[model samples]
Target: MRFLVFSLAFCAIFTYCLANRPKHDVSEDNYLELVREIEDEIAKENELKHEAREKDNLEQAREENGQEKAIVGNYDEPPYTDKEISYLQLAREVSDQYMEEIRRENEESENVGARTASDSLRAFSHPSRRTQMLAEENERQDAELETLQMLASGENLRMRNLPDLTAKTVQDDPTCNTKLDCEGKNLNLVDGKEFRTITGTCNNKLNYTWGMAGAQHRRLLPNAYNDGKWKIRKLSVTSRPRKKVFLPSARKISNVVHKTTKPKPENEDSISLGLFYFMQFIDHDLAKTAEGHVRKKKICCKTPTKATKFCLPIVVEESDDQFDKDDCMESRRSFVVYRCNDNVRNQINEITSYLDASMVYGSSEEEEDTLRTKKAGLLKMSTEDFLPISERATSLPCNATDVSTCYEAGDTRANVHPGLLTYHTVFAREHNRIAKELRKVNSGWSDERLYQETRKIVGGEIQHIVYTHMLPVLIQDSVLDQHGVTKEYDYKDSVDASMTAAFSMVYRYHNLMPHKLNLGRLKGDGVETFEQFNQESVFQKPSFVTRDNYDGINEVTLGMIQSQCPYVNRFMNAAARDLLFLDKNGNSFDLVALNIMRGRDWGTPSYTAYRALCGLGIATTWNDLTNTTDQEDIDKMKEVYADVQDVDLWTGVMTEKKLAGSISGATQSCLLAMHFANIKHGDRFWYEGSFSEDQLEEIKKITLARVLCDTLEDITLMRENVFRTNSDWKRCSDIEGKIDFSKWQE
Candidate 1:
């Protein structure tokens, strides 16, 4: 009994030892190695199978041709058959399953000893895991095999193809040249009709390509709709059966879309009053559509009494009846018609689209000739001591109706406001400063060379300020990323950087205009002396800047920074209801009505189309607009339009909620992003292009604040954030943040 019991104990101990031993000693590396071996065996078997099939085909062909068949040579049989290949693939799958099981087991026993051999082996032998692994492995192997076969056979691999990044050339793209090559024999004529005569002589003709000092030529994009031929591209993605159906009456739109309300201050402070004028300066540089000479009679305004003819009467709602009954004009007293460029004879076309600072330098040769001094590349200036003197100076011609009222140089719209005149003066001074510095650096440089170089530098400065300082504040970071607006040094010629209709209309931020302008001076005692002027009084008035020995100009600059801009949504009563540029009788037109009409005149698509274009959800119903607009604004839209699709682009954008971290709504933000992106990416001579490393470095140092300090004579200190006023104003000299111009010394 003792012997039997001892034997039983020994047997039990041996069984325990076997059960605890490591199962097969398998690991991830070992499994991987086994898989590789199986893969090799399968490949070899597949090759042998291919050869066998080919041999059979050859034999069959020979028999059909009645040719004698050669005896087969004695060769070693393939190491693996088709069945063996299948088995090998199965083995690889099993190895994969074992690896997965081992991984799971290792995780389960991480803090403990190794699991029993029986349990591990059982998990590895799981039939379901083996079947799923085999299927996945087969699919992967088939794909890889197909790819390899395609490569070996020299077939085009679709997976290897990528987007072409080469610049498109004129040969391939019809819209690739600078010159407007007309189909007629005479360069000056278009199709039997005389082309618009070039106004200036060719002696100091501007270089159409390089924008040299004497170059007065402005070239349109080769494929631009208005490029000599009247081929205006339709802006709408889909055509409406009745074009007028898509277009709501401008007066009706103004009454609904831009109804005047109490003024609301913007949530954020205006960094600098200069920004308002700066935008205008930039706009002048970009676009100046010719005005129509013929006055077309149209009724734009309608009162409760009757619809009367002005340029077009603005329809007023009862809520917007702030105008005195006696004071209300039946028509727009001052009607300057917009010039037409298309066959329709109603479409307006911009004269200049390049960022060449044409606003300050002058758009045409004749204008440039009048502005240039022909000595030291200096611009003509007013002799009056009190006036600001620079290129694009506000100086009256001797034959002017009122010599006291100054005529603006460069852009025709330069005399739009005194604030814009201030910006023009500052930038013009900056150009002379740069020119003088460059002359000192290179004494042998001619007036032409000096002028062109100075212009280049000024353009660079403008581009830098816009991209670095202004854009970040205007657009959110996410929107910038979404639109790919980040700096790209390489030039992309394929990009058509022309301004779009939507961008032109949405950018009209007239609501930001304050009702009054403040003119103030920083006194010797550190106390500010301020005097307020009405918006109408400052229009086309540069005399205010010259009055009191130019103290008013200094006071105006100080006042601009001191004042806060009103909210963008609430148009001041002055701008929305009673904009200036009136006749002698003091009859005025509604600015909002003009903006809405301009959008229609430009043929911009309705709001819903733009929403779809911008990747936003289309508002089929008022309820669909909830994501982008306020509930009250959506309700207002519903009251105005029967269908959401009929809502105008400007109206929809204006009513939408401001995007997070941005002042404009999503649609406007998207449009701005698209426009700015085109400007940056499309321009070959972009400021951030592959110019000399040193030149680019110098250009980067030019900031708006630094430019202000360099140009402003009396102002010593200024705030770092020019857009907003500081609690305590700092002197320009005291501001440590000025850009170092010394790096530009060459």
Candidate 2:
């Protein structure tokens, strides 16, 4: 009897200890098993919820059939959809099931210690202490499980889960109709004349300190200057109001000059195809659309009889008749008007001189979110078969469910042309490559840190390329020196970098576009076979890069350098003239005409006025233009305009002979030089300024050639001067010319 009691007591104490062992102290295998069991239980609960939903549906159906259901008093709302009702039912069932499981588990854990420990064992082994410890352990395990569930649902992550709280909230003014009208309320306007300068209390509402840069008030209220309030000066012969000059129609001018002038393919003196693309990239970085019209309907032009308030067609005049008799559409569709923020008299009311890599990284919080992947702070790239590809293909995203438009980094016009798209792709890839390198170097750095650092480096590269390679070629060294655009770094508050109307008009160098895109591969022996593609065919198409195992981009890069650009003249390529967009019914619109019209619409003074402003000789007669332009070009202007004073800036600039050792004419070169000089002087974060000595050194090493070699795939050989067409192709492995990114490493 004694032996039997001793053995029973020993067995009891051993079992009690085993039962009371801490539930949190789980072995690896057992912990995994527990997780699997919990997952299985959750799955079973979902199944039960689904079944409960089905049963509820059946019961409701039976009740409806058995008796006439009475409607709730005073409520006439329609019943919820079957899917919606079912989802709600399932959610309720799941919640109830989860609660019941938790309660049952708690009860079982609490009773385990009590059931295992007998009265004699409890006295000797301290049952209350063991039970309390077990309860505490169970609570911890429950808390941990809950945390795991939350983590799995991705609720704990910072940028990934939370809404962007830093987004700007813009309030629209109800009284204002147009952007110009909003500014007019505060300004004193002369009868039949537009407000030339911001006077009075108008300066108080518009903040020039941190707001957009404008042309007029260069010091205190720069953003308010020329807020679409300037009027085109009238010609000496015309009696039209200054605000309402009866200028020639954009379409009519296009038909006369652009349609008549055939494509004159004249290669630039020494500039490369890379330079052309880089210019376009820079254009997009600085400018955006002024608040203007939008197209109401796609078919608005087809049926003029059904014209509404939204339909403002570009009426083609009889004198400029270049279109075929049968195919000549009477009504060319116009853009629909969507005014900018009239309250502030600015587009988005943001400073334009920041040059904060808005072209690559994006400008707004929403845009930033769309561009970011939230994984290592890398910008999102369009993928092919789950493999990372280029910047999300322009028109469509990979996972787009509908025909809605897709997103791109920085600018919307980045994918408007093939060359622009190629550059965007290279820089995007560069950002990712740098981010990956940074991650490797600083193992503990987060995605945000890596992305920002990479962005800074890319911005620096752009600044270096523009200032070093492009500016020298565009604006001659003499003009740069005259304008004080020296390499010396200084931030001047008085210098306004706002894009002037003349600057914007002159920058439209569509005449430089080649008719055909030369696509070819550069061989090891520095020879290549060019495959010519019509420029219109690849306008917004990015799929061309994926051809030949993604080697087409390199081929095109080489081809652009090899192909010659057309001379800057009235003539345009057939691609730009004949097929700008399919919706326009085979190039119904003309780009040159649009440029002239846009300049006038923006209320910019004529070429003579701009010449006077720049301290050059103002031409009063057609013969006076001989000093600035060729004799033949002057005769062409006489036929178009009544007097030299009426000549549009765009027409005059394009016709002028290219300045000696410069890509552009005198007026264009001057405007570009002044604008760029101001952009450098005014910008607080100009790459050369406020950088560490080491950072500045690294930035100076960056060049367009290095950027191309580093970012482009399989670009083994590259010319030293990427901005110029040359036969000196050197291997990318040549360390003499290559930029060393080691200094950027943490």
> What digit string (tens of lDDT, one per residue) describes model 1 on residues 1-746?
12221222233223332464323323433533433343455456566667566455434533432234411221433222343333323423333443343345444532211222222212211122212233233323332233222222332323211111101100111111235323344122322423212221111122222222211112221222222232222233333556523334444456565666554554474545556667777876765443221111222232423322112233443334434433333333111112222222222223345565766776555666776777776666664323223232212211113345454456655555777777777777778778778777667767876676677678788888877777776678788878878756455656555545566677766766777787767776243636887775565555666667766556777777667666665233454345544334444556665666545444455777788778898667778888888888887766656578767677878887887666678888888887778667766556776346767887886667778777777877655666655445566666543433444444
Indicate the residue-level lDDT of 136 in model 1. Answer: 33
Q: Estimate each model's TM-score.
A: 0.62, 0.64
Candidate 1 stretches greater than 4 Å from native: 1-249, 269-271, 295-349, 384-401, 523-529, 570-572, 582-584, 726-728, 736-746
Against the true structure, candidate 2 reaches a TM-score of 0.64
Give Cα-based local distance difference scores for all models. 0.51, 0.52
Which prediction has the highest TM-score against the true structure?
Answer: 2
Model 1: worst 10 consecutive residues (lDDT sum)? 161-170
lDDT of 1 at 61: 32
Root-mean-square deviation (CA) per prediction: 32.0, 24.8
